[model samples]
Target: MPVDLVPTPGAGPRVTFTGLGGAELIIGLTGQSRQMSRWALGFILIAAAGTALARRGCGSKVIFIVVVLTVASLLALWLPATTDVANGAFMAGAALVPLYILIALVQRLWNSLFVRNM
Candidate 1:
């Protein structure tokens, strides 16, 4: 790491600080799915259990459920949308770059949450 590699305050390269949904970037990470399958099953189990619990009474576990569902969705949307064969408007690829980043963040968060498995 060299000082020259760093940019000055105002001279820094511009970055669009998208809020949560800012840039939608999707990344397909391989090899972890097999390891995480149990967690995935656990999530499904939780979903089914949570639905039953919700019928009984809403609970804090909903947050965890929502987060899990969100990860599953973004992961599903990420890889195919960003693939080279993905067809869309001319800017699809350019726009997908940010979308892909959002996916990466979700993946990172998921990985961190399961650090032992990760």
Candidate 2:
């Protein structure tokens, strides 16, 4: 490699660091590696499971809704970081998982509260 091609300490071109979601020291690029947050992983798993469950007996509309929401949430949480772009709005996707969970809880509560009386 040419001497000029070497990345100097603190004098190299600006490099955007993106989170690798648990991958560390990949291909000699330490800057790209990041520890995956447990919260993020949990949310991903929940969304995946929810999607799977939604497909079993739910209508097409319901399945579509679930898939879209889950995809959008994942994209929002990960796309910006993957692309090396700084967009705070993308982080909002992290909330969607909990939001969906909350919605389910509310629905269950409603059903339990009223359906049992019938």
Using lDDT, give the best candidate's number.
2
Q: Total clashing residue pairs per candidate?
A: 10, 0
Model 2, range 6-33, lDDT digits (tens) per residue? 6768895777667857534423332433
Q: In candidate 1, what are the lDDT values of residues 78-114, reduced to their tens digit?
A: 8553322222221232333354456557878987887
Give the winner by TM-score: 2
Task: Tell how far residue 79 is off in model 1, in angstroms.
Answer: 30
- RMSD to the hidden true structure, all candidates: 20.8, 13.0
